[model samples]
Target: METAYIKTPVGIARIEGDEHGVSVISIVDEATQLSPEIPNILSKAAQELHEYFEGERRDFSFALNPRGTDFQKAVWQELRDIPFGKTTSYMELSRKLGDVKAIRAVAAANGKNPLWIVVPCHRVIGSDGSLTGYAGGLWRKKWLLEHETPPVQHRLF
Candidate 1:
């Protein structure tokens, strides 16, 4: 798999993929070297990610090939269905998966999502509407959510 690193507002993002598709996009906190040149296979993903961070794009159009179990894949697919700036609770996601009791399992799969922002696991929240847990970091999650949020409009009465 070809790998590349790019600087994002949150931190350095590591992108991995090949001809098949992009398999991973994750954040790294430790100091790491950025790619001198992005590979042809990963250039679109890198550019799309930059567009996402810049608020120029709402949805990703590149191919994704995240490696995971069937259940995890199902959960990740549902995550993509969530609107660009909307949030959903773990319970609600479990309900959508047709198994309310699988809340824990859904949460586990969400936590294991490898595509990061591409899969949008950060959009999942606690039932109480709290920014619960994120593999990247809660601060980063908050930043992502805030970044996606549409600006408030004022009415001049």
Candidate 2:
């Protein structure tokens, strides 16, 4: 897999993939420099990510190939169906996956998602509307949710 980095509002993002498709797009938790020469596939990912962070694009339209088990792949694909700015409880996700009893497993798969903004694992929240576990850190998760959410208008009565 070819890897490249790009600076995002929250942090440096590392994108990886080849002709097959994008395998991973993640925040570099250990810090990395942007690629001086970006590959074709990575360039498309970086551009879409930049647009996503800029709030100019709500959904991504690039090819993806996240590596995971069959169950995990199912979970990730379901995550993709989640609309931008919307939040789903782990229980709801588990139900969607056709097994509410697998909520914990569903949460586990969600946590293991390799593609960051592309997979949108951050959209999962607690049943009571509270933010929950995010591998990229809660702050970044909050930022992404806020970024996707439209501004709340105030009424001047």
Candidate 3:
């Protein structure tokens, strides 16, 4: 596995992965350099993330290989299906997975998602339309949500 840290508008982001794909992308307070040998996967992920933050890209084009259990993988897959400018609730996701009772589990899986924005985990919210738990701080989640929303039109006076 290879690792590299990047600075973004929200915070420092740590990226880790290998030839399989990106396994983790998390926010932190400081940047850390990877070993002198840079893996192709980590380099690609970093480039894609840079494009994403620059608003020059919408969907991620790089491959992902997040590590998790079957259920967690399923939940992460569902999160990836969420469109860039949309949001869903834990209840909605639970229902989509065909088990409304699994809200807690679904939420836990969402919380454990390692791909962050690339996986679109920030699109999920509380049932009452409130921003809920995010591995990255809720403020960062809020900013991400706001950033994805379409620009409002204004009329000239």
Candidate 4:
């Protein structure tokens, strides 16, 4: 797998994948060195990420090859369907999967999502709208969510 590390507003992001598509992308510390030579595939991913952070893109368009079990794959796929700037709860996801009792399992899968922002696992939240666990840190999760949210309109009544 080809690996590339790029700096972002939140942290340094390590991207790993090949023609088969991106398999893993996780945030590293800001002190990490930026990749001097990015592979073709990883360069594409990095560019898309830059646009995402710049608010120029909402939905990502690229091939993904996340490795996981059948259940985990299903959960990750559902995470992709979450609209930009929208949030869903683990309970809601479990209901969508037709097994409310699998909330814990769904949460586990969401937490294990390897594609990071591309899969949008950060969109998942607690049932009470509270921010929950995030592999990249809750601060980064909040940053991602806030980045996706549209600016509120100021109306004079």
Candidate 5:
């Protein structure tokens, strides 16, 4: 596996992956430098992330090989299906998973997502339409959600 650190508006992001695909994109409070060897997988993941941050890319088409339990993997896959510029509640996700009572478990799975923006974990919110716990921090989550929302055009000249 290869690793690299990328600086973004939210914070320092650590990317890890291999030929199979990117496995993780995590936020760290401190900045850390990566080794000089840049693997192809890491390089591509970094480039795609940069495009995403620049508002030039809406969808990620790269392969992902995130490591997690079966339930966690299921939750992550569901998260990826969430459309861009849209949000879903934890309860909603539980319902989709065929267990409306598993809200807490769904939230737990979301919190463990290792793919970050690639998996679109930030698109999940609280049941009452509030920004909830995010592994990358709530402020960053708010920024990501706002970034994905389409801009409102005004008629004023």
Candidate 6:
């Protein structure tokens, strides 16, 4: 798989994939070398990510090939359906999947999401609207959510 590391506002993002599609996009806190040359196959994905960070794009159009079990794949698919600036809860996701009791499983699948912002696992929150567990760290999650939020306009009157 082709790999590229790009620096972002929150941290260094590691993107991996090939012609088959992007398989992983993870954030890392450690200091690491950025890719000297972006692979030809991953250029689009890299550019799209830059647009996303710049608030010029709301949805991704590139192919995704995240590796996971059937259940995990299902959960990830649902995550993609979440609006760019909206948030959903674990319980709500479980209900959408037609299994309220499967909340834990759904949470697990969300936690295991490998595509990062592409899949939008960061959109998932606790039932109480609290920012919860994020493999990349809660701070990064908050940064992502805040970045996606539309600015509230104040009245000049």
Residue lDDT tens for model 3, 46-101: 87888888887778878788899999999988998898889999999999999999
**Judged by TM-score relative to the true structure, which candidate is superior, 4 or 5?**
4
Error of 4 at 46 (Å): 0.9
Error of 4 at 55 (Å): 0.4
Model 4 accuracy (lDDT, Cα) = 0.91
lDDT of 5 by residue, 1-157 (tens): 8888887778778998888888889988865774455677788778888899999988888889999999999999999999999999999999999999998999999999999899999999887899999887888999999999967999998
lDDT of 6: 0.93
- TM-score each candidate: 0.97, 0.95, 0.91, 0.95, 0.93, 0.97
Which 10-residue window in model 4 sums to the lowest lDDT?
Answer: 26-35
Task: After the best TM-score superposition of candidate 1, give how far the Cα of residue 60 lies from its true spot, in angstroms.
Answer: 0.7
RMSD of 5: 1.5
Q: Which segments of model 6 are wrong by more than 4 Å?
A: none
lDDT of 1 by residue, 1-157 (tens): 9999999999999999989999999999999999999999999999999999998999999989899999999999999999999999999999999999999999999999999898899999998889999999999999999999967989979
Regions of candidate 1 where Cα sits further than 4 Å from its true position: none
lDDT of each: 0.94, 0.90, 0.86, 0.91, 0.88, 0.93
**Of candidates 4 and 1, the better by lDDT:** 1
Each candidate: how many clashes? 0, 0, 0, 0, 0, 0
Clashes of 5: 0
lDDT of 6 by residue, 38-105 (tens): 89988888999999999999999988999999999999999999999999999999999999999999
Taking all chains together, the TM-score of candidate 4 against the true structure is 0.95
> How many angstroms is residue 63 displaced in model 4 relative to the true structure, after the best TM-score fit?
0.9
